[model samples]
Target: MLWTHKILWIATLVSAFAFLGMTVDSLHRMSASTHADQLSAQVIEGKRVWQHYDCNDCHTILGIGAYYAPDVTKSYSQRGAPWLRKFLENPAAMYPSGRQMPNFHLSSAQIDSLVAYLGWVSRIDTNGWPPSPEGVTPAEDAQRAAGGELAGSKIYLAQGCNACHTIQGSGGTIAPDLTHVGSRRNKSWILAQINDPRRINAQSVMPSFAQLPESAKQQLVDYLDSLK
Candidate 1:
């Protein structure tokens, strides 16, 4: 019985040591590849800005924070720097939707830092989390190729449609996915909704775009119609 007990203790010690060694090695490897290891001065400052502004109050980073806004882990990649800059500069104008984001009135320097920080976050390997597939349909691509000129695409971003509508698997979840809006609604109906969503749905929270120029409205409608 004494010998059996000794053998059992030896086995337990061996297993514990193996587990400890593996754990230490894994931690060491992860630490070497951590975001901190690649952070630049600008990115670090941008992180500070993010915290200073308490953006986490509304948005989430790396699966942390309130669900009031969309996850920003890959926002830099999803929304290009130009669009991000415009949105940050004037959230109200960009969204104009019912749930409009308040403008921070951030200066150019602050905007640069925030964008830089987000860019850094976008590069991190998140193990394929928050799956955001490029939802561009083939028809949409063909339309874009045939003299679409991206005018509508720009207008869509400028109007902050993504704030309430999901396109290509990104943006807020409050509204329906618009990846194939053209297939769901006719162009005239879409135009009507844009002009005044309340006219279509009495309970809709979408704000009116009646102030937009006639040509701009047409361009936006055309762009949306291209989404198959």
Candidate 2:
């Protein structure tokens, strides 16, 4: 009878250990899933801040939107932190010819968060939408293939520039109407202003076009010029 009691106790102990092991396994899986969800939420939140402020109106993400402004997907990698912070604080002082972005007066914390968000986006894969401009003798050839002056319009949509600058009586009203910018500014002037925007105005808010290729430059110029 004593031996029977010992066997029953041993069985109970084994069952308890098995249950504990299963519980631990389940808990680990749950924790892993939760972590994945949290990461996804972070990405979504960053995108939220972008859309909430209508960033798409001036900047282009991957290649799915308008291109009124610069392609910010690569800003984090190409631009330094100081330039990003300074520009975020005062864009108008940097580019004057066609100032757009308003003074959000964001705090340092906000700027940091925005920069973090931009950094996140800059890392996402884009399957090469804007092919490299290398090997092309004539920039115009690439421009024609990329849609010429229409390329600028496409960039405008992707960059969200239309949110501030107007074209053909459409888009936001905060900035000047660019429906006729092609006619007003010389091509060289536009190129110079875009390449190194700070040269135009120290207080200009327009973000500089850092990664725009020389070939795409001519296409954008042609597009802007065609606007007239």
Candidate 3:
């Protein structure tokens, strides 16, 4: 009888634990039930807009989704809020040479929410990802600070330069390793190469920066110059 009673006690305890687990799950789900009640509404709404527009079908985020477009998760630190907003308004205006991302014609309210959402997404602790701060500065601002030209480390990503090049053993290997390039080339040499690639290497696969504004060129150059 004592053995049977102990067995019954064990069964009861198991049942109680199961009930507690269910209750905790219910509370979690309930807390996440409403969008407005979510931890970050801007992120939620931004996710909503992202899904509604099927952006993943074209672009990747957090290393998931399609590769046809640039990864946007790093845009905050790379492009900053202003450039991101402007790009959303008109992609062609920002990069005449690049493929177009259609203007969504989002309302002011929607834009605000989107910007907030992007900011929230940007803070999602990627464990010091992208390996760089991807400094915040306009192309013009970086150029003036660097004097002749900005290192343009960010330009490597912005111009899709990494699509063909590698950096610090990361990125594609199709082009070249650019991490220690600054040590190899002077500012004038770098400027001349970027401004007129054909002049240095007639058969070079890299694109010319002639079309890019001098300010943007300087910003990119500055970013590249900063790379180790």
Candidate 4:
């Protein structure tokens, strides 16, 4: 009985030590993985802003919070600063249809701070979490290679145009709907818009995507021009 008790005590100690060691190792690595040293003062304020409005109640970040809205963990990287700024400024204008994020009427400073904070959050190493559950392929780099998806459509998706423009009843509504844009605008006009939106409309809030490869620009233009 005494020896059995001693064995149990030794096993418990070993297991406890193993758990403690692993916890310590994880904590040590977390700082590097999350880039904690980059947590700037603006970022902290952004976090405060996020909490001040209870954004978690409607959206999820880092896979924590309600699932009612889209996960914003990677939204910063996916949407880009310009798009985010536009959307944050007017959530209703961005998504006129479907579930709408209320117009918080947040001040410009607040919006900038929140954007900066989200930027930091997006940089954290999440080890490829929040996988695309609706997609056919699990591989990140696997571009609909086997599917019959259009090359132009693929380019549009890759460029994140859906962040502002609605196409075929899908995508964001912040910008003009492209469901029938082909019928309204010519190919040259579409190309110009892609290269520099401000050229067409001085008041256009849309950012220029002139940096995209020439081939990609043509492909994207083809996709947008075919939305008839």
Candidate 5:
């Protein structure tokens, strides 16, 4: 009985020490992994703003904070500076529907700093963390909210269309919002725009999707068309 008790104590102590060592090692590597050297004055100020406004109460960063809002660690990379600027300028216009983000009334300078801080945060080597489930199924839940997944929707996301266009109350705002594009444009017109934006507008910066397989392009057109 004494020997058995001794073995249990040893196992418990070994497990506890191993956990402590891991925690320490993770802390030691945090600075290097997060690129502490890249934290600029603007980024530091942005962090101050984040704390001052208590953003963590709603949003999460680095997978830490509340679940009330979305994680913003990769927002800068996914949405880009242009998108973030417009959204910060007016949260309602960017997203007016359900589970809205409260306007923080952020100043231009503050907005700039926040974007910079988020950009820096996006670069942190999280080592494939958070297991980006959205990439695998872009229209998984969100698209279902709109109306079950469309094959074309997958292509649309794969082509990064959301980066420049807003649809279903989400995505970027650099270009036209495609939330109701079906009402404004016909399927043929949509296909033409995708095939070659320059053909419609000489100065259009949208790249052509003509390189995509014909079937895939058709599916994307269908997805865009279904938005109405």
Candidate 6:
């Protein structure tokens, strides 16, 4: 009975020491601020909005949350503020692919705050957590540098095409995979569809790109055409 008690005490002490060591290591690692002084008043408000909306329910930030949606940790870096604002304003219009991101119908002020919060979140060092930019290709980079197709690629990103469409194994799967759309559709048909998707398919949900600059539209067409 005495030996048994001694064994139990030793086991409890070992567990306690292990737990303490882990806690101390975690604290030491966290000594440097992940967010630091980047959180401003606007950022704080934005975070409040994010929490109030429970965005973490659908999207993961800093590797925390449900895996149903994309990680938003580096959204500011990937999409930029303009695209983010537009997306926040009308998520359905941005990507009619199929994964429905309900429109929150946020006010301009709320949108600003949300973007600010995301911007701040983007500044945190996660030690290369996400690891790479999504949907980007070496060929696309080369085309972009050459200035025609790349310009269209920029327009695609600016317009938030990835929200609905997947490209080269990246982006959402709500809509048709556009990895090789160029091979399936000609430039004229693609342009016509972008200008008025309803002309081709009565049930198409794609919004018109007629408002975009002609150059941007043409560049986008060229980019899509080059996808083959």
- Give the top-scoring candidate (lDDT): 6
Structural similarity to truth (TM-score) of each candidate:
0.54, 0.41, 0.46, 0.68, 0.58, 0.62
TM-score for candidate 6, please give it.
0.62
Residue range 147-176, candidate 3, lDDT tens digits = 643445545566656655667877656556
- Candidate 2 residue runs with Cα over 4 Å from true position: 1-45, 135-228
lDDT of 6 by residue, 30-140 (tens): 646465566789998999999998899999999899887888998897777866886798886776656778888899999999999999888877887887666778887
lDDT of 5 at 183: 88
Across residues 101-121, which tens digit of lDDT does each residue of candidate 4 receive? 889999999999999999999
* Cα lDDT over the full model 1: 0.81
Q: Compute the lDDT of residue 137 as modeled in candidate 3.
A: 53
Rank list by TM-score: 4, 6, 5, 1, 3, 2
Off by over 4 Å in 3: 1-39, 128-228
Predictions: Cα RMSD each: 8.4, 12.6, 9.8, 5.4, 9.3, 5.8
Tens-digit lDDT track of model 1 for 122-222: 88777788875468776877877576637777677756687789889887677789899989988899899988889967987676676667887888898
CA deviation > 4 Å runs, candidate 4: 1-17, 132-184, 191-219, 226-228
Query: Runs in model 1 with CA error above 4 Å?
Result: 1-27, 31-37, 132-228
Order of quality (lDDT)? 6, 1, 4, 5, 2, 3
| lDDT (10s digit) by residue, model 5, range 102-211 | 88899999999989998999999988966856544654656563653456775676555776788977887668999988888999999999888899899876766666
lDDT of each: 0.81, 0.69, 0.68, 0.81, 0.80, 0.83
Task: Tell me the lDDT of candidate 4.
Answer: 0.81
Per-residue lDDT tens digits for candidate 2, residues 1-228, read 699999999999999999999999977776554343344544556566668778887777776566787778777765545557767887764443364777778777667767767766666555565566555456666666566555666565554466567888888776678898978998888888777767978765567665666776677777777777
